[model samples]
Target: MKIFYPLIFSIFLFCYEISGQYYPSQEWERKSASSLNMSQPLLDSAINIASQNENAVNRDLRIAIIEAFSREPYFEILGETKERGGPAGLIIKDGYIVGEWGDIKHVDMTFSVAKSYLSTVAGLALDKKLIHNIDDKVYEYVWDGTFDGSHNKKITWDHLLTQSSDWSGQQFGLYDWADRSPREGEIDDWRARKLYEPGTHYKYNDVRVNVLAYSLLQVWRKPLPQVLKEKIMDPIGASTTWRWLGYHNSYVNVDGIKVQSVSGGGHFGGGIFINTLDHARFGLLFLRNGKWVEKQLISKDWVKSVQKSSKAKSDYGYLWWNNSQGSWEGVSKEVYYAAGFGGNYIIIDEANDLVIVSRWIDNSKIDDVVRLVQNSIK
Candidate 1:
């Protein structure tokens, strides 16, 4: 019986492996010849430049870098690095990795970086006319009694993308609320009411993005994860070892009824975790105007729209940060990025076809890193 038990366990493990239900080993393998060739000389030059930066060796910088690895919150979360720790990052210059740090195999959380990726998805949906336009009302698709009455009717897709929705306050607080209660009412109330006219003001709110996620799901009649895998992830050949947090919960309204919801329900929020190399690949697509290996992954026009500044916020577009160091002395005006909390970043310079990905420990000195990189570029 003991021998039979061991044999049964071995068979079960074999079946699990065949079914792709087990975690693969962390052996780092080069993506492909084409993907690898994207960053040769540029990476060499970047490494040379990075080696010379005083901040790279300075005590404060070194401490900050270490703390980033520890995911401390003493440092402010700016750019892609959030309060939470991020995954490894890949830097690509002229479509090739100039440098990489952290584990290339371990997937890191993308935080708001997911927002930028989702924006790309939105672009594709727009191309398919699944989403008509930026100005299309969100309620057009989510018309299920989830949101009803006055302010709900006024919310539009643009409002969510621009973070100009009236419910920004609730959305902002929803994160904290979710941490306390993972129940359905926790989410519904977060997106329950309109605090102001949609698009009249700008407020950074995660809930608005959640609303966008919900709308996309409804339009496609599938979950956001599945949609991404089919539309974006598979085509780009991104690492399959990634996960999207959030999108599961029920919200209870003031009326005390359970609302079936699958949007941004988590308070702290979730991100798309990916490895550094895969991130570089994703950044390469953006750098090439949404083309991957000569194939158009997303419409060029849609890419342009997402990269351009929205009317609501001069420094924000769709889900991308227009310029983290826009006004900084050394930062290039042409630089735009997909930034997340805990320093997870994919910084792209479209004009120069440069992409810099950095996954740092949470709460690192992002400003210094940004400054150092900017100075190096100069």
Candidate 2:
């Protein structure tokens, strides 16, 4: 009798462990779908299109798109339609999600898409007096003494946003950091050096973004993730499961203490991972001018400022990329976008009231992808 009881107890424990490993609770399932809120008409159209579009690429093609450009081997493509291998991609027209694809119940990484989101957060911080101005030297908050004697001190939030920091950092090199984990000292050494006079030229560097993240921490007296959550994520009803990646492989930092960087930060920095549906929710937030449902998450002025292009050759703005082609195929030149390596994109056409988001594997022919997106809209 004693042996029988012990055996039964052991069996119960094993069963519980196995169930826990495979079964996501109802709460988790709900959290995964938290970002999915589409209007009926739009959802219906998306579903119809998804079902009928024979040329629509499959998951394999989507993965190929990202693998061509990114070091990461895996990817997910969410769309605003109900179809095979779909992840939830919220299609917003005039500020409401009308359709979704894939598992609307899953959250994904947004990668550099987080940059634009962070920029909006910074704008809100400024409006609330949490941050002063774009021209304010970042060293004012996090004084590392490196910018003191160099022209780099002139580098401001404005410069970083516009990708005009003039630091001579290569965009592809920054994108490659996902595979190469450099030491802290190496990163610090690079930070200390000025590639060009601040605000005098344009360069793309992920390290500059890290500095931005660190500056936010210094000024807010809270981690960047927390600031984002309270100021933007919660208001937008964003899922609590999301995260952002940061330097040193940490998510959130308090003074000297380090925590896991949020998935958004890590994915954008090439350290974290996520699902496709969450990406769409993020897009919806921007499409709605920072208003999510009943709350004003970010100021509209901030959104306009970040979306507009700076006086740079690349037509960049606060990490957002503006239309540089002037006109393509009679299409109006009023498009702005937030793009990432491995074919992640959030393109907003305010004039047309459209927001398009896609996640794919890295691809060498990014121009082809861009052209395809443009053609689709036309």
Candidate 3:
């Protein structure tokens, strides 16, 4: 990919400062593929590959949730679930829409892509000094019994962000070990296993992820949805249609107000229900290093940190999936994305000045989509 070509993109906003590019308002500007110096045929192929290769996740998300976690002990959807639409996506080059297909305005469950949004909130907290440091023990801020245990006491904000907490506990009636138990082990044996030192093990458990959400709620002293909306979403000109939801039982009293603690992903159910356009806006924010026009909404340091690999998992970062360890073969190692169930994604290619959002595509086609999109540039 000619990552530098976007700075000199022939389409629009040319000859401006490197950081100065289009910022969408209610209506986003569009440019044809050929005008952007991209092969329209190749761009069309990328969109067709995404729109045609629909994922197998059921439209009735309740059933989809059930089938997904069927192996978990007594797994149940504790939050609201919505039926999803067909494949939809957007391809933005130089902050302008270059290629799009399917129902881009249709709101759908983005699943774990919400985790990356959660990471943004954490970065905001750090920027505001609410979180003094990333490595600070979470127990310091959340003095409650949540992180009281010996094992969980060592868990820092970084650990939770990277899914390396190995925090053992229950939240909103969901058990940590029960969420994704080793299929080979018996239920009794799974719980009896030794806990890995905090930040040493990488396990993808939604219950643990929600624990991070709950901890952040304590630190922010308000609803995380509020933090996200004010600090990230609104500044980027995102629509009001998006919703960040949690389980029915996830509400907690904070500052004399009942605020629902949001989830990092829709594991049991209830995450971000957002349209493809909004997702594109979010990716564009990261592509611009958390800036919106003249304002640096979030620190570039934090933005760069999210792309770095975590010690526990080389392909993982602060709730963001990184390509640093080459998780996707032949794809740029600089690319990082938020991937979710049912093939949802918000892919950020900063080096190329691109943001791509796709929903309900086949999981296996993402690499090809990236390759084709990158190859489209001249």
Candidate 4:
């Protein structure tokens, strides 16, 4: 009897996956607030909320990076850092731009939001069997000395995606321990500290995140940006203005051809420099459960996997942030997002059929932004 029910549910899910939907193309169609059955005033107020509360980071992003990560020993911007502009964002209700503010076309650094895109690359790898399973040890594919150590060899794709890898070692002149280390620790204390069993601890370390990028590069044997372009960005009809960059020293020879490895975030500098509309497109892809119109861009299973809470961090998934842990009180646990430094976000509210991208806004006000937008729906 139990097996019969399980089979019936599986058939229902399979049918749902093949369903089609309306999606945006190169020029996204916009609808009036009233057309979408949303409160005009309330929607305007929500847009104002995001446009007004700007992030406090310096306009000269070089200074901003220094001030933010200054505590780390000898921290410097190793990747590209450029001057940033004012707040910008978009609100997509049912795949249409229902609300927007600031320069939607302006190109700017999106910090750690790149991690979500990197996570998508991993999903594609899994879909195409470039990676057999997320549970497989990374050392099996990346036999290079990078994962040679006893501790690192224990790491898996799962651990890296969740930032729980606790992967030790240096990548591109940055040490894993030195990144976001404890405020009270001395250098030697961090260096000599006992390792956490891979996947047992969660730490937001850019060095380790970069290690994931480097490992993916090894598996793909091509530049990640090219992979992203072919597999994701282009298919979704994103603009050519965006770029995924890494450190000056991050380039390595892949099969005798020198290719650059991209960074997961804009921590020490280079990450995703993207505009708002492209972000909206990326968010929409996930909001639809990886289904774009009739084409399933990525597997439905991968989309679901990115939202599940991992053991180490209940509010974090494979590079996507979750509300399940109630970290953002009053927000629905079903709402998951891709967040980056300086208030960059690609928030997905599947319940509302919405994709909200808020950049350079006060990070604290994000929940209010979400709640207000949700309230605007009639």
Candidate 5:
């Protein structure tokens, strides 16, 4: 019976892989709130809720980063950042826009939301057999000094995806120790901290994330932005204005050609700078199980994998945030999201066929806004 079930599941997945793709038009289809079986008054209330509460950190994003690091301006360290934009959002129900607010066309730095995009890139690599398995030791592919030590050598692709790698190294001129260091630790204590066994400790460190990016660049032998554009973005009809950027110093020699390795977020500087419409488009691709207009942009299996919680953090998936705790009232625990700094979220609720892209919203009010949208459905 077990053998029979395994074959059945494999056949089901194979069928999904070959199914025809679905893609959105250049302009998202718009429908009246009531036409979508949503209450107009309740939909208006939800939009109002988003518009009323702006992100508390919107006054100066640069100052927030500076304060976190207790250092000089980020421009001096990480280089130029795309200008941060004001609150913007889109509510897509069954692939059509039912609600939208703020400047949907404005492009801004999306911060760590790019990590999910990076995760998708890794997924593509996995599908192509460039990586045999997520559990494979990264050192096997990246023979450079990045994973030479005993501790780092134990790190696998899974650890890096789950933010549990504890990879001890520097990349793109940023030391792993210096990123998001504990506020109470002494300088030496923070710098020489004990390395937790890889996959045991989860720390959100951009240096390690950038190292993962650089490692993937070595595996891909080309610029990541180009790969993303060709494989995922262009097929899904993403805007040209959206850019996945890397630090100024992140370029490295790959096969005698210098290729830039992009950052996972805008912590230091340079992540994905995109508009809300493009964000919605990306979110819809996942909502549709990675299929886009007669082609599978990313494997359905990869989409399923990203939603599964990691052992190190139940609330986090592969660069995506999970709602396992159901903190958001009326939202399903099955809902997962790609979240970035400054309240950027691409919340996907497959059960409801909904995609909510919220930018620059107050973090505390996100749940309420989501609940409001859920309540509108009648």
Candidate 6:
């Protein structure tokens, strides 16, 4: 028995060594572009391009904030927003930063990218058995009026994660129809529009996402941020500067204590406000299949499930963007990313063991940046 134990320990060490060290520390190691078989000049070019094309939205963040308000019920929800942010990006190859540009430490509103984190919290809840199955109706766990209706009761956790729930109701003082409603329709018409069965149609609605967050809070019986920090971030060595914010009205009673349900985007202004390096660490977590060093912070099966394309949306998987069309040419079709408004992205390329975090870049230029990175590889 003693001999068998020693042999197993040696094999474990061998596997760990060959697989490379996971960066389970606040500081990320840096590697030269040439060391990773990448062209340093091309990498520099990629960084420069990203810096120049900060964001297609607006160079002035205040103007962007005003525009965000104008898009309410048309392109987004009317929630809280901060008028602070600038261009920043980081490139990680084999868990090391090869190149970076702009203010890598600036905390900015990550827009819809918060949805990915929200989805991950769902995964954690599932992993801990707080919820039995993704297929189970959310109404079963959340006995609130949020899922009281027939259509809403049909909404499952999978439906919410996939943005196909068509969940009807107001949450956190935001009406369902007031979140990214069709621009062509009148407010009342859009509000009274036909409801689709859960998981049958796709709609990027923050109200529904907030509903998911609130439900998760009920199940967790604590703040979602606390759950994330305790279960994932701290274990992965993420910094404390990061914060998940929700609207002032987003509080709800859970287990006799008031818990605030966080937003999934900055659409209304309250979402994840974090730095570029923290975003990179989160991306690396997913890239490594939810493992941080020796601990599987999130289950491997959950990670795989989040990347699987939804039936309702080919290019979307549990809030993450999938490259179903293989639009990047040389990049693997398995490549998926967490994208947000104003070009914030945490791209995970499991094929290359890479995680790229780009903040406040031109949303339209994401593909170009990605392509540039791919071309740098020899």
Instruction: Using TM-score as the measure, name the better of candidate 3 and candidate 4.
Output: 3
Q: What residue pairs are clashing in model 4?
A: none
Per-model TM against the reference: 0.67, 0.64, 0.94, 0.93, 0.91, 0.91
CA lDDT for candidate 5: 0.84
Q: What residue pairs clash in candidate 6, if any at all? A: 79-268, 80-268, 80-269, 81-269
lDDT of 4 by residue, 28-55 (tens): 8789989889998888888898999999
Off by over 4 Å in 1: 1-87, 168-194, 247-269, 361-378
Q: Which ten residues in a row are the worst by lDDT in model 5?
A: 68-77
**TM-score result, candidate 5:** 0.91
Top candidate, metric TM-score:
3
Best by lDDT: 4
List candidate 5 stretches off by more than 4 Å. Answer: 1-22, 71-76
Query: Once model 1 is optimally superposed onto the true structure by TM-score, how far is the C-alpha of residue 3 displaced, in angstroms?
Result: 53
Candidate 1 vs. true structure, TM-score: 0.67
The per-model lDDT (C-alpha) reads: 0.57, 0.53, 0.89, 0.90, 0.84, 0.84
TM-score of 4: 0.93
Q: What stretches of model 4 exceed 4 Å from their correct place?
A: 1-20
Candidate 2 TM-score, true structure as reference: 0.64
lDDT of 2 by residue, 1-378 (tens): 787998997875564234232111122122111243323443455444432332333344334334443443221222211112443344444444434454554544445676776676578778888768778876566565524545556777787666666533222224222323345456545445546666666655555665565556556766666777787666545566766555444344466775543322333333223455445556656666766554567778887887676765457788787775653334446777777544556777666556666554233332333343334332
For candidate 4, which ten residues in a row score worst on lDDT?
Answer: 13-22
How far off is residue 79 in model 5, in Å?
3.2
Off by over 4 Å in 3: 1-20
Q: Candidate 1: worst 10 consecutive residues by lDDT?
A: 72-81
Model 5 Cα displacement at 30 (Å)? 0.3
Q: Whole-model lDDT for model 6 versus the true structure?
A: 0.84
lDDT of 6 at 319: 89
